[model samples]
Target: MNKIKLVLALVIFISFTALKTKDDDFVKRSFDAATPLYTSLLNLTGDNFKNYPHSFLPNGTVKYYQIDEWTGGFWPGSLWYIYEFTREEKWKIAALKWTNSLESNQFNDKHHDIGFMMYCSYGNALRFDNNPKYQQILVQSAKTLTKRYSPIVGSIQSWNQRKSKGDINTWEYPVIMDNMMNLELLFYASKVTKDDTYKNIAIKHAEQTMKNHLRTDYGSYHVINYDPKTGKVLHKQTLQGFSDESNWARGQAWGIYGFTTTYRETKDKRFLKTAVKMADFFLDHPNLPADGIPYWDFNVGQAGYKPDWNFDPNRFKTTPRDASAAAIASSAMLELSTFLNGKQKEKYYNAAVKMLKSLSTDQYLNTDKANPYFLLKHSTGNLPSGREIDVPLIYADYYFLEGLLRYQKLKK
Candidate 1:
C-alpha cells in the first residue's frame, strides 16, 4: 500500500472509532437493561406456547406460532445478539434454549425461510463460537432450503404451489425479493463444509432476483410470479405494498440487505453497486417522511395524498409506518457504509444514524413497560390482510437491536 493511502486509512479508522464510543455505549446499555424483560417473557411462555414467540396482542399476551413458521427464529436470534452485545452467560443460556426449539426445521423443506429460521439463530452462534453441532445443523438447513431451487427458473422458489392463495395454476414458482436475505446461510454453509454447491446456489439466486425482481427505479416488488417450466416471468405484483407499482418499504429493505450481504460474501462489485442503488431509491424517495422511518407502503397515498410523518397512526388509518423495514435497512446500511468510502460512505452512515436516533426516542421505545411484550411500537406487519397492523413485531425488535449493534461496530 502507498504511504499516503495508509495514512488516509488510519484517519478514517480513528474517526469511526471516535463515533463508536458513544453509540456503542448507548446500544450496550439499552440492551443490557432490556435483557430481564425478555428473559421473563421466555420463562412465562416456556414450551406452553405452540409457536415461536413473535409478538404480542393488545392485551399483552405472547403472539406465537404453532410450528416452525418463518419467524420462529428471530426470538433466538435476538437472544444471540443480546449475548454478543453484553457477553453475559444468562443470555447465552436463553439463546441456546430458544435456538434448540427450531432444531426440527433442518428437515422442514416446506418453506423458504430456513435462513431466517436457522441461520439467524444458529448461524449467529457459530459466528461467535464455532460449535461443531451448530455447523451440521446449519449445513443441513442449507441443504433443505436448496430443495426449493428450480433449475428451470434458475432461482430458489419462495412459496409452494400448494400454498398459493389464488388459483393454484395462476402463480407458478413465484419468488420474492425477501429470499435474497437468506443467501447468507448458503454462503456460510459453503465455507464451513468446503462445498461449492451452496455458494453457487446463492450466486445464481441473486442473479435471477437482480434480473427480474427490480423495477426501473431500482425498487423491488413483493413477488415475481415465474413460469416454472420455461423460466419466464408471468406477473410482477406487490402483495404487501399498496399497489403493484408501489414499493413496499420492507421489500425494498430486504433487497438492500440481500444484495449488501451478497457483496460481503462474494466481494462482487456489481452486488455493491446494486446495493447502493437500492439505498439511493429508499433514502431519496419522495414519500419518505422527515422522521426517517417509512410508511408501510411508500405509495399509500390518497391518489395525491401527501405523507405526514408525524401523523398519529391511531387517527389516520390509511398509512401506518413500518418500523421493521426501517430497522432492517438501518442495520444493512451501517454494514454497507463500511464497504465504501468518501461521500458515498458518509451518505449511508448518516442515514443509518438518523434512523437509529428516531427509533431510540421515547416516541418509539416503550420505557414504562406498558408493553412488556416488545421494545418498539407502531410496526406495520401486513396492512392488506388486516393482520399485525400498527403494532410491535418481534422481527422489528430483533433488527433494531442488530442495527444498534452494527452502529456500535461502525464507531469501533
Candidate 2:
C-alpha cells in the first residue's frame, strides 16, 4: 500500500508541475504577444478610440463602428486586460480613454448586450481602479438593460423588432442563449446598488433560459422566439447558425459561458449543471476538431430532425472554423474547471489548455503586423450571409486575451 501510494504521489506532483510550467509559459507568451498589438491599436485608434473595431475588411484595412454596435465594448475591454497584465502606464492611459468613450451607452436601452458593452469594458476598468464614474456607468448600463426585460417573458429581450435578410424578424420577442452573458452586468449592479431587482431580473432570465433554451443532450438553440403578451415560447430558430435546428458552435459557447458566470454569481447548482452539460456537448462531440477549435456549427453535414448543415466532420470538406467560439469556451471552461473535482475537473481544464495551445499557433495567431490588427484568424461571423468567413474578428481577440488572463489568475 505504501509503495503504490508513493507512485501515485510522484505522478501527481509531476503532473502539477507540468501544468504550472505550461500556465507560466502561456502568460509570458501572451504578454509578449499583446505588447505590439497594443502599440498598433493605440496608433490605429489615434483620435477616435471610441469607434468599436468590428474586424479587418478583406482589403486588410481595419473597420470601426459606433457604440451601438454589439462589438463596440471589446476593444476598450481588451485594453483593460492588457493594462492589467502588463501594469504599464501607456496601456492604462489608453484603457481609460477608450472606456470613457462608452459612458453615454448607459442610456441606450435598445438591446440587452449592455453587459457585454459596459460590463466587459467598464467592469475591467473598475477592477484596476475604483472610479465613481465607472460605477455609475455600470449601474446605469444595468438599469438600461433591465428596461428590456419583460415580466411576461421572464427573460430580457435579445433582438429588437428589426427587419433583416435573415429570420430575426419572425418573432415579437426573441431571446437567444447569448443573452445569458449579459446577466453579469446585472449581477454587478445588484451588488453595487444593494438592489435585488437587478438580481431578480437576472435570475428570472436565467431560469427562463434553462427551461426553454436547451435540448435533451444540453446543446442549445440560438434563438427562442416568444409571445410577448403571454411569455410563451412561440418557436425555436437559428439566426447565425447553420439551420433553425442546428447548434451553432458559438451559441453553445455563449450558453456555457453565461451559465458558468451565473453560477459564479448566484451559486445556483442548476446553472452549474447546465453549464457542465453544455461544455460536455461541445467537448465530447465527435465533430470537434482535433486541434480543439470547432467548426461553425456542430450539426453541420450531420443528419438531425431538421439538419441545416450538410457537411460531414470525418470526411471533411470546406468548413469554416470558429476560433471565437473556442476562445469563449476555453475561458468559460477554465472557470468551470474551478467548480469541479477529480476526473471532471481534469477534463475541462485539459480541454481548455488544449484550446489555448491550439489558438496560440500560427494558423490562428497573427504574428504579422501588416495583416489585420485582430489576433485570432478563421473566425466566422454570419456564415449564411457569407460575411466574414475565415477572417480575424475583434471579439475573438477580446476573448482570447480574456482566456489568457483567466489562466493566469487561476495559477495565482
Candidate 3:
C-alpha cells in the first residue's frame, strides 16, 4: 500500500510540473514571436514615427495610421509590454521613441479616445519607468479630456457631431461605452495632482454611464445619445454592432475592463459589483464560443436581433470572431480575480486561463509569415461599415500581450 501511494504521488508531481512548464513555455513563445514582429514593424515604419501600424488589409498588406488616430498608442504600449516581459534595452529604446512621438496629442480634445491614445502609451511608460515627464504628459492629457465633459450631460463626449457620406448628423451629444476607459486618465491625474476635480468628473461620468449605458441584464449599449441641454437620453443606439440593441463583443469587453479599473482605483463596491455583472454577462452568454472567443456581436444571427437598417441573414456563418475582445476580457478577468475569494475567484481565473490558451493557439495567433507584423487574426473592426472585416488589429496584439503578462504575474 505504501509503495502504491508513493507511485501515485510521483505521478501527481510529474503532471503538475509538466503543466507549469507548458504555461511558462507559452509566455516565452509569445514574447519570442512579438520581438521579431515588432522589430520588423519598426524597420518598416522607419524614422517616420508619426505613422503607426494599425492593421492588416484583406489583401494581406499592413495598414498604417497617423499618430492622431485612436489606435496609435497601442503599438508603443505593446513595445512597453514586450520590454517588461523581456527586460531588453532595445525594446525600451523603441518604446520610448514610439511613445514620445505622441506627446503632442496631450492637447488633442477632439475625441474621448485621447485616453486610449495617450493613456495606453504614456500610462504604460509611467508604470514601467515612473518618469515625471510621463506623469506631466498624462496630467495634461487628462486636463484636455476634461474639456469634453458637460455638467448637464454628466459624461464626456465621445465624438464631435459630423456628417459623412451623405448621412446627416443627428447625435447632439453622444457618449459611448468606450468612454469609460478614458476615466482612468482623470483618476490618475487627481491622484498625482491632489485635486478632487478630476476624480469628481470621473466618478460622475462612471455613475451616469452605469445609470444609462447598462441594460437590466448588464449588457452595454455601444452608444448613448443625450440631449446636450437637459441631460435627457435622446436615443440609445449603436454605430458598430449588428443592431442598436445587440451586445457588441468589443464594447462588452471594454465595459468589463473599464469597470474593473474603476473598482481598482476607487475601491467602490458598486463598481465592483457592476464589473462582476458585466463579466458574468459576457462569459455566461449562450452565443459565446466554447473556445471563449465571441462573435463580433452576440445577437448577429439570433432571432429578433437583426439590425433594422441593413439585415443580412446570409452573413450568419461568416460573422467574424473578435480575438481582441477575448484578450481584453481575459486581462480584465485576471485582475478581477484578485479582488474576489473562493469559487468566484477560481471561476474568473480559470476562465481567463481558458481564454489565454485559446488565443495562443495557431488558429488565432498569427503564424503566417505573410502577415508577420501583427499578432492575432480575425478581429472585426467595423463590420457594418465594411471596414477591416477580418484582419489582425494592433489593439488585439496589445491586449493579448497584456493578458499574457497578467497571467504570467498571477501564476508567479
Number of backbone collisions per candidate: 2, 3, 0
Residues 1-412, model 3: lDDT tens digits: 9999999999999999998997778778777877888888888887798789999876767898887889989999999999999899998988998999999999998788999999999999987788999999999999999999999999999988753221534788989998998889999999999998999999999999999999999998988888899999988876788888899999999999999999999999999999999999999999999999999888886888857556566865676899889999999999999999999999889999899888888888876664869888888898888788778899999999999999988888
- Candidate 1 per-residue lDDT, tens place, 38-65, comes to 8777777776535677777877687887
User: What are the per-residue Cα lDDT tens digits for candidate 2 across 1-412?
Assistant: 9999999999999999998896578666766776787688678879685577788888868877787878888988888888888898989888888888888899988888888888888999988888998899899999899899999999999988654334345667989888999999999999989999999999999999999999999988888889899988888877778777778999999999999999999998999999999999999999998999999988776766454444234543578999999999999999999999999999998999889888887778876553636777889987866678788788888998899888878867
Residue 22, candidate 3: Cα error in Å is 1.5
lDDT of 3: 0.89
TM-score of each: 0.89, 0.91, 0.95
User: Highest TM-score: which candidate?
Assistant: 3
- Worst lDDT run of 10 residues, candidate 1, spans 304-313
Point out the higher-scoring one by lDDT: 1 or 3: 3
Kindly indicate the candidate among 1 and 2 with the higher TM-score.
Answer: 2
10 residues in a row with least lDDT, candidate 2: 307-316
lDDT of 1 at 122: 90
